[model samples]
Target: MLEEDLLYILALQRVKGIGDINAKKLISHCGSAKNVLKEKRHVLQKINGIGAFTLQHLFDKGNLKEAEIELTYIQKNDIETFYFEDKNYPDKLKHCIDAPILIFKEGNFNLAKQPIISIVGTRKITSYGRDFCEKLISELKPYNPIIVSGFAYGVDICAHKAALKNELQTIAVLAHGFEEMYPKSHKKYVAEINKNGGFITDFWHNDALQRENFLKRNRIVAGISEATIIIESAEKGGSLVTADIANSYSRDVFAVPGRSTDNFSKGCNDLIKRNKAAILTSAKDLVEMLNWDLETKKERAIQKQLFVDLDETEQQVYDFLLKDGKELLDIISLSCKLPVYKTITILFNLEMKGVVKPLPGKMFEAI
Candidate 1:
């Protein structure tokens, strides 16, 4: 994006009543942020959803002054800026309707063609949640997915540390600006994160750290990934809010199940009970569900070898998939006379064997 264009976009972003959704609307109608600001009040007012209050903030001169200062800071620090319309913007996040029109990034990771998953959960993570979160990332290392998290406490930090341990890029989406870190203790990990994955946010360098910023931050965590995984959450928490946002974007959501009495597990269980998220037990479950294992030539060779050694049940499932070409999990269970849960377990084993691949919309096909 041109410096002139970026300047206007920053100014537009500062408009109080105009958010990403409305800013996109104005940009779409006027062709650019500069044009949107240049258009007369009467012209902007005629557009749908452009009402009095929004217009009242659109032409503030202070916004321009602030944008210039922010732009200078950005230039001096060599921070990268991703304009929503830029070709280099995150592919998944770009599709989200409420995604920020501009995002500032401080990382070296490339998001292209890589599977990205956001892991979030309770601030008071239990021992079970910690073990599961760590093991999950360790097992998923072969797929080399970019792990995304809030960089708060508990599950978020666990996921990032696990990713770093596995030598995988992990992104920390911050709630505040670059000028401040939320939990001062986590400042120790910032250099390591930047060395591997990095940080991203829509807020300016000096934007105040506020309660609402977290909710706004959650949207980016949810939108940027193909799936969101909740390791643990209480009955109410920001992770649950992130899951809801992911669902609203029609992305896959997975929740780890816990004992009925575990407080942190309540939110995940509720999501499963309400049919808002699929049950996730192991790394294989997610790998199969997302078809992350079928992407390479070596994996294809493994797929061919899987047909050579099959137990009775594995052979039965493989044969069924071979004949049907592709089928839903429920249909496979019904036709093969296996229970649904049993069928899921069998399919997961089959996926690891590389003879079957899972598809979107809960479908599967034989390799």
Candidate 2:
């Protein structure tokens, strides 16, 4: 984004009572963040949900000064900024209504065309949880997914280390700003993580760490990926909160099942019981559910029928799957530029014609 727009966006972000949803509303109505600041108070007040309180600090001159300072810091540190509308913004996150308008990134990784999943659990992890977390990442190595976590203790750090060991990109979503690192002992892993994947946060460089920040950061962990995996958790913990957020965003959630008597397993079992998450027994379950194993499936030697018929839309969807192998329904919809409902209907039609077959996890493969 241009510096001018970024300056105004930072100022808007600093305003009190104006969260992402409202900021986006204001920006949409005014056509730009800069325009929103310059818009007449009466004009803004007329917009739905734009009350007097949200606008109280909207016009604060100090907001601009703070934004300038933060922008300078960002530039000095070589931090990258992704506006919500930017093409480079995380694709899944962009669809989330509550996603941050802008995210600051410091990493060597690129998210383009890669599958991403967040693995989160209790800070007090058990031996079983540790083993499961490590094994899951190692097993997923062939798919080369981008692993995401909060960069906290236990499962978070374990996931990061596993991804690094497997030579895969792993993103650490921070609850604090780039200026501070929590659990100071984990600072030792920072250099390696930076070299491999890197850190992401919506917080400013100098923002102080706060208890609530962890919960707030969970949304990013949940929203930025295709799915979330909880290796272990107590009946109540931040990882469960992340699961809830993932569900709210309509993302897939999986929980590693454990002995019912185990304290940490209670959360996973409860989630499975409540139908909030699917049972994750091993890497194979996740691989099938996400269609990540499709690439490894041997090609079927089926001869094409000379008389098989298909419409333009159906042909488009079929052609994509033929080239890409089995793919998620949403991916097909996106690639075909068709609505999901339309894609499903077309896929069904293709199925009827014996040209496609449905698979687990809402995926379809051309026959």
Candidate 3:
């Protein structure tokens, strides 16, 4: 979490030719960015991939100073940084071979809290694909899915809109910095997304938007999500690259099948044909997949067995909370089927076993 460590790593990643693998080797052997910056060519020579040209750039005076300047920038911006070793880092992404050592993010995204599923596909998405995205996410609203996707045009944008519509927290894995978004048209959604979710990138504030970054971007989009859903994709594009990377990370991938003759869905159909992706028919499939991993969900099912069916009073209280996540007193006689006096009695018992959280207003939500 220290600014120095984050700055050094971020600066090193910005090197012209260095990639994740090269940067990893440098960090692993040298121990710190400060050490790597100070090392001579001979010291770096011991590493397999460190060439003379690479070493020249590594030890260059300009790069070293730029690293310090970037660190200062981090302090000034209050930019939050996450390292691979950090507890709050995404567990799913940490396992990937090319995972970045540092991720620069803005807003309040809690990567540790839930299962993430990325939905991605063609930039020129069909009406059917957009409809599927909306319906699937709506069905998943009850599970509180934290949807992840590139906030690009077409399918990426559709998934994000659906996530927001369903009132779920979603993360947009950006290809550039929080200071800028590649597609200028998405600037407005980026603002809305900031309030509801977050944007993540490894590149720094001044990082330029280039076509090459999109390739690098795909890895992160796929890495952070538990499962990647390809809604509509052409034979070769960023979405397909992301799906391939998701497979490399040993993550499950699902594809929404589209018309066979449609060029836009060619990549997804090919993946399903090769068994590279599971054919996803609905959001229930994703909900069930994610539900299996929820620790509280299994316990809830068992606890539900205990009650089997709620009594008249219990049913009233339970029914009210099911409609919305609320606090105390609001659950009084209105929302529930029971009256205030009886509801309070049942609320106490439900609160005792950790089934619900009692807020100041006395509203309740499933725990």
For model 3 the local lDDT of residue 101 reads 79
- Candidate 3 wrong stretches, greater than 4 Å: 289-367
Per TM-score, the best of the predicted structures is 2
For candidate 3, the lDDT comes to: 0.76
Q: CA lDDT of each candidate?
A: 0.89, 0.89, 0.76
Residue pairs whose backbone atoms clash in candidate 1 = none
Q: How close is candidate 3 to the true structure, as a TM-score?
A: 0.76
Q: For model 2, what is the error of residue 228's alpha carbon versus the real structure, in angstroms, after optimal superposition? A: 0.3
Ranking by lDDT, best first?
A: 1, 2, 3
- TM-score of each candidate? 0.81, 0.83, 0.76
Off by over 4 Å in 2: 294-367
Tens-digit lDDT track for model 3 on 1-367?
6766666776687677777778877877888866787677787888988887776566555665777777777778877777876787776666566888788777666765566789999999899899998998898787676899888999988988888888888898888766777688888787678778888888877777878888778898888877899999888888888888887665678999888899988999999999899999997777664454456665675676476555667655654554233434532454453567877778777677556677543445655
